[model samples]
Target: MQSELIHDSDFGRYLEDFKEGMVIRHWPGKTITESDNNLFSLLTMNHHPVHLDQHYASEATHGQVLVVGTLVFSLAVGLTVREISGRAIANLNYSEVLHHSPVFIGDTIYAESQILSVRSSRSKPDRGVIKVKTTVTNQKGEKVLSFLREVLIPKKN
Candidate 1:
């Protein structure tokens, strides 16, 4: 007997669906660990004591070890790539990056992205520009990171 097949829901968005002011909240939150902070800091050549040394970080404002800022930013951007611009032709630029709050170890993070603008490319008829604002929040509902980025995506035929 032959088995039936099932298809999973698609996570990627089509070009026509990229509308201005559209917001998309990504699923699958990730927790930051002490080890994660240390490893990321070491791997990226960021030897900041605030991220690596718990004793030193404990004396800081938050009184605890904080996650590397760049790591959190990278994670937030990575989370939205699949649904927003996994098939992007090119990344144009990034702007208005703000670090609203510190991300501490053991904090779970999730992200949401809002489509700020979309414009058809005059030179490349088959591609278009998409500008989006991404915000990342910690488990305590604190906004840790936010940024605006632009990318080029292929048009749906």
Candidate 2:
């Protein structure tokens, strides 16, 4: 017996879909939870008291447990995966990562990205690279983190 394949829906954009100066705002922001912070911290082998110990963080400058910056960056990247890197062959580089403000456990994070450049690969004509600047903001619209990432995506033939 032969098995039949059902429908397929593509989740990400190809090389030909990107344009310079184009902005993409990701939807449905994620709220940071205490467990989320703790688990991420522990999973990454980061045992900083500020991210785990409530009493310690209460006495710190922020007066609260700060959500790990790396977690925020990861969330930002995840948020863009469906729109930015869904069809990516590889992630080439990540640079200029900057944390601008504090993120707490209850903060809802949102992300937006702007295409900085798109160039076809000279060696491999079937693929291309895209550079984008992503900005992550909190529920209050305050910019919390920003960075640049380059991804290689295949072109539509």
Candidate 3:
């Protein structure tokens, strides 16, 4: 007996569906909150006074608690997953990660990604490698983070 394969249509796009220069705007931006910063910091073992202690942050340059960088990076990448890498077999690499501005509590983060390149895998014929550049902006239209990521996506037969 032979088994059939199934692909979830709602998951994400296949490699063959992606095109160079394609741009995707991720929906439903995320709002940074005090609890978000606190929990993310504590859970990650990031004991940064600026991200946890409001009292200390008040005296700091930003004059308030600053959100952790990893938190921002995590959310930024997460926002692009559905449209970019949700169906990926593996994340090949992440590069050129830059945090351009600070993310504070009450800030809503929105993300958009542009396809950079695509290539069929030499060792694998059933999948292709895709590269994309994602930029994360705040509600105020300020760029907060940007990065490049490469993923391997299965080709539909």
Candidate 4:
């Protein structure tokens, strides 16, 4: 006897589904933690005292250990991946990244994205490029980070 296999998948939006000015708010915001900051800082070899040393950071302007900016960026982007690029061929580039405010441990971060452009690939008929501008904000609605990312999404079969 032979057994059958099944494959079920939920795909991200295709090029035809992206429209200029489309807005998507990612849910289940992530809260920054001391462990998260420390682990990410150490794992990435970003031994910035402000991110790892609480005592050292206390005397700084923020007066507390600041979460690693890249960690915040990575988390914010990851939160949107399922809706933004789950079926992507590849992430092409990240541009115009700006850190508007500092992120601290215990602060919850929420992400939102706007579709900037969607165009067909002149070379690859099965893929298209989708450009989106993303913003990450804290629980208090203060903008912490913003950037643009372009992804190559595969067409739905």
Candidate 5:
């Protein structure tokens, strides 16, 4: 008897399904809250006043607590996981991260990604690398963050 393998349709895309110009918008926007920012800051040991101190922030440029930049980046990456890297073999690189605007508590964030490049591995024929640029935007449609990352995905054989 022979056994067959099953692939879940809702999981990440394979290398063969990717195109250079493909774009994907992630669902279920996340709302940043005071607790979210504070917890993330505390967990990451990023005790920055601007992100945790409302009083101090009131005197700063934004005049409010700014969400930690790393937290925003983490959320963006997490938002894309289901569609982009859910089944990825590995994450290869991340670069060109830019913070375009400040994020504060109560700001809702959404993310979208565009495929930049795809190439099969030279040594490993069953896997390939996909480079994508992901953009994060706020409720007002203002771009808050953007970054480029490369992930290794398996090819559907």
Candidate 6:
């Protein structure tokens, strides 16, 4: 069967679609490279040795270069936007951010998000709060990072 193509703007979803415990796995994982770490660290003005200096990183706990935590977090969030929050009104906040393990160059990362809770906004009848737990894992199925975030989503009229 042929599937119809749905444009981003034309695809609208209701709050009920984001039910609690619903898990959305983002496909086409990204492979982290040496250049990615270096560029991300420099772009963010984070000159930390763990991410920028290979020699220094070799002596650290992991004995290798580490990907910046923020970069991983941003990538995870970016991966979910298309499927989860393409039409979101606003991102409320992030909580429970944890760096469970270090990410190294050449590692592939995949993202999964679980809807945690939802609540109707009192002031905004057309919007509601959607809380989700996002996790980034490597090819080995090891979770390297995770966080909880909430966003305001428009309700179906």
Best by lDDT: 2
Better of 5 and 6 by lDDT: 5
Model 1 residue 129 CA deviation (Å) reads 0.6
- Poorly placed runs, candidate 3 (over 4 Å): 1-9
Candidate 3 per-residue lDDT, tens place, 101-145, comes to: 988889999888888898899998999999989889999999999
Flag the better candidate by lDDT, 3 or 5.
5
Per-residue error at 23 for model 6, in Å? 1.0
What is the full ranking by TM-score, best candidate first?
2, 5, 3, 4, 1, 6
Q: Write the per-residue lDDT of candidate 4 for residues 1-157, one digit (tens) a residue.
A: 1211212334466777677778887776899888888899989999989998889999999999999889999998898877789878899999999999999999999888888889889998988899999999999999999999999987765
Q: Which stretches of candidate 2 lie over 4 Å from their true place?
A: 1-9
Better of 2 and 5 by lDDT: 2
Candidate 6 regions exceeding 4 Å error are: 1-12
Candidate 6, residues 7-99: lDDT per residue as tens digits?
343443567667777777776688988898889999999999989888999999999899998988888888778766877998889999999
lDDT by residue (4-27, candidate 1, tens digit) is 111243655557768887777787
Worst window of 10 by summed lDDT in candidate 3: 1-10
Q: Is candidate 1 or 3 superior in lDDT? A: 3
Q: Decide which is better by TM-score, 1 or 2.
A: 2
For model 6, name the residue pairs that clash: none
Give lDDT tens digits, candidate 5, residues 1-157.
1211223457688999888888887887899999999999999999989999899999999999999999999999998898789889999999999999999999999998888899999999999999999999999999999999999999999
TM-score of each: 0.90, 0.93, 0.92, 0.91, 0.93, 0.88
- Model 3 TM-score, 2 decimals: 0.92
lDDT of candidate 5 vs native?
Answer: 0.91
lDDT per residue as tens, model 2, 54-140: 999999999999999999999999988988899999999999999999999999999888899999998999999999999999999
Winner by lDDT between candidate 5 and candidate 1: 5
Measured with C-alpha atoms, the lDDT of residue 110 in candidate 2 is 90
